[model samples]
Target: MSTISVREFSYNPSAVFARVEKGEAVQVTRHGNVIAILLPGSGPVARYADLVAQGKIRLKAATSADRARLPHYEVPADVSPLDLLLAEREEDDR
Candidate 1:
């Protein structure tokens, strides 16, 4: 972990990011108070994976039975969705 002032981080963001890309964490400070942390990653998706690996994030697993029981969109084969909408519009007009 390393500390970088906000002004320094802002003035040379690429250099700060370069350090992070090397798997180093950087702490940004404003008025000597820590404000943010920059971690090594290409983007949020990669950061999320890193967080998960670090145990900083936890995810719930869905069971096969739970997935099977989930509701699915079932459009009736005999009726067009446009027909239903038109019928509803007609009812509303009346």
Candidate 2:
């Protein structure tokens, strides 16, 4: 792990970028207050797979119709699927 002031990161971004490229985490501070972190993103699926491989999490498989038609559960016919889809799309863009 490494710590760098926001000023240092701003003045010489390559140095912080190099540390991130090496898979080292970094903490960035502004006015002595922790503001952000820098890390390499290798994609969510691969990272999730690695976590499952390391037993950090458990995996599950669900059958079709288990959702929207489970015995005690159901999706209302009038449910607004479009609204949910739009929200998810906005989150993905973020």
TM, every model: 0.44, 0.43
Q: Please, what are the lDDT tens digits per residue for candidate 2 over residues 1-94?
A: 3678988999999988886675555668998875766655553233555564455764343234544475342447787777766776899999
lDDT of each: 0.70, 0.63
Q: For model 2, how big is the CA root-mean-square deviation?
A: 16.6
- lDDT per residue for candidate 1 within 6-44, as digits (tens), equals 999889999988877866667789999867766667643
Best candidate, lDDT = 1
Tell me model 2's lDDT, rounded to 2 decimals: 0.63
> Residue 61's C-alpha lDDT in candidate 2?
33
Please list the residue runs of candidate 1 whose C-alpha ends up more than 4 Å from where it truly belongs after superposition. 42-94
